[model samples]
Target: MMKYEEEYWIDYIKNNELNKKEASELLNLDIYSLMKIGDSLRSFDTGDTVSYAVSYNINYTNYCTASCPICAFYTPYKIKKYEINKPNKKGYELSLDDIKKDIEKAKALNVTEIHIVGGFNPDLSIEYYESLFKEVKKYLPDVTLKAFTIPEIDFISRTHGVSIKDLIQRLKEAGMDAHTGGGAEIFNENVRKLITTPEKISGEKWLEDAKLIHSLGIYGNSTMTYGHLENFDDIIDHMIRLRDNQIDTPGFLSFIPLKFSIENTPLYKMGKVRYPSSGDKDIKVYALARAILGKSIRNISVYWVALGKEMAQIALLSGGSDLVGTAFSEKVFGATNRKTSTSIEELNHLINEIGRIPALRDTFYNLKEYY
Candidate 1:
């Protein structure tokens, strides 16, 4: 980007008045200034440092239709024996029965929320999810069910030939409450083409679909997949797209800055996962996300899988509040977060160590029972 744009981002970050274009001067920031910006944003309003057992994701599946190249979860059309030093395996798609068993396990753990999202299961994870949600309510009525994305829904629609809105309504009626924004790696068409390509829905379509979901009253989180190939400009553009979209529908709950990892991903095979820091460009995006998203979004998630427990604890102090929920069974995000699953018990203790409450929250950020 032009040098002047970098200046604009610095001032806009500090002042919060400039439009997205002018404020994205961050694209031109020198290393030192960028670090300071990251530091400043890191210290911004992350509530209650004491760890609480607020929640963790109950990861439901490892199967998906869109095998985005940068993906961490799904395997090649067939199974692969690769387990990235973690317990995750890429080929096993959990069935509705498996999901039910997971829910039982999570309820036993006293988890307040179940953050369930699986890949585009052409084999009926859609109606399966409906059954899962209803069964969850039947068994553990208090536990919240915040599940899946509209894009996954879109995939199902194409696979099933139903309209997206109709799919959303069906899921909602069946017991899916909110959405957790995975799948939206970055929202720029050019960067997306350069990075994620065909496996993903385009940046514009993701937004359009997300907006429609919100209009339908399903609140959800949004995220960007960075650290692979795109630079700061692409990051800002993605943030701007979401920020602007939020002006229309505040239901866009939070903007997450996802770090890229090469573990078990096509990008890694291309050799894109190395950086000087313990993590890499993904960590940079985290600090940058804090600096940019600021308070417009209520929460920023640090997935234990990719960041690992130690780095994630550091992230809590660095402008991250939402520690992602526990996953009973997750092999996908496990690939990126770098862990198949982190128990709620472990996360609560970790956040406590770092002086942040592990506030268990539903997909909509509604606090759950602290267990």
Candidate 2:
């Protein structure tokens, strides 16, 4: 254990440009002390306004070829039902009409953002996404259409014989507002290999494509999936890498510390990872995000579906300033045996209950309404 004087470390964290060694040292501070510094930093940078997005999630398909070990949502192509834990959870693909219907429902909710991501389905082509985006824009012309991860983009571009630049340009013309930071599990090569698979894009490839996307005038978020086979050093390196990238391109709007949910996933079933990370560790991860990247990525999102509503509230006080979104009809976290449903009303209540100002925002973190 490292000796830490809380006041000194807090002042140091606020005053100086933190290097990797100093960040590692700060990780050893008491969890409560870390939270104190994180909350203070949050107040200083992002203010007391806690933001949420009125958004809907559209998981176009669960059929995937990239069978990452940490994923619970993917159903690989031609996989036998009985070969998996849940036989009833077979793969299914949604047509363009089905996606339009989802958009109609989202429009009924007056959603300002439409979040779309899915598995790397080999059957879908670049034309499929083009038509899908065209149809979505035809219906919800005003809603911000944030779609696809860097891995998904890379897969679609390579498998369909389209350059990444051409793919993103075509999608932008078809109506892609932004990208999601889903496939960035972690930056450390060893830990990333342990959690994800070869089919998924490499960490280096993810960052390269992200910079390319930023150069195209497209914006996106960043995430680090922690709590599974990753040490403090891995986490610190991940943040630093993202911080450097943001400095280069100025594209990442937020950094979301995604907690690895182990239930019903390969990591859990294979005896490689037995349990979810503790609440103590979870809160500390949020604080660590604040300490490392708070200045660079001002919005640290507390994903309620992964942390549960109560724990997510605690995370808000720790370092988080965004509740992600309502996450209407989310399925990925649900596959991990976690509840993935919440309403705007419930989100507002959660923020107000914590004695913070609740505000709705769009994909770009622009404030929409204050409650």
lDDT values, one for every candidate:
0.65, 0.88
- What ranges in model 1 sit over 4 Å off? 1-63, 76-90, 197-199, 272-283, 335-337, 340-345, 355-358, 367-371
Model 2 weakest lDDT span, ten residues long: 1-10
lDDT of 1: 0.65
* Residue pairs with clashing backbones, model 2: none
The residue-level lDDT of candidate 1 at 139 comes to 79
> After aligning candidate 2 to the native by TM-score, how far in Å is the CA of 264 from where it should be?
1.2
Candidates in order, TM-scores: namely 0.81, 0.95
Best by TM-score: 2
Cα error, residue 247 of model 1, in Å, equals: 1.5
Q: Compared with the true structure, what per-residue lDDT tens digits does model 2 show for residues 215-259?
A: 998899999898899988888889888988888888998988889
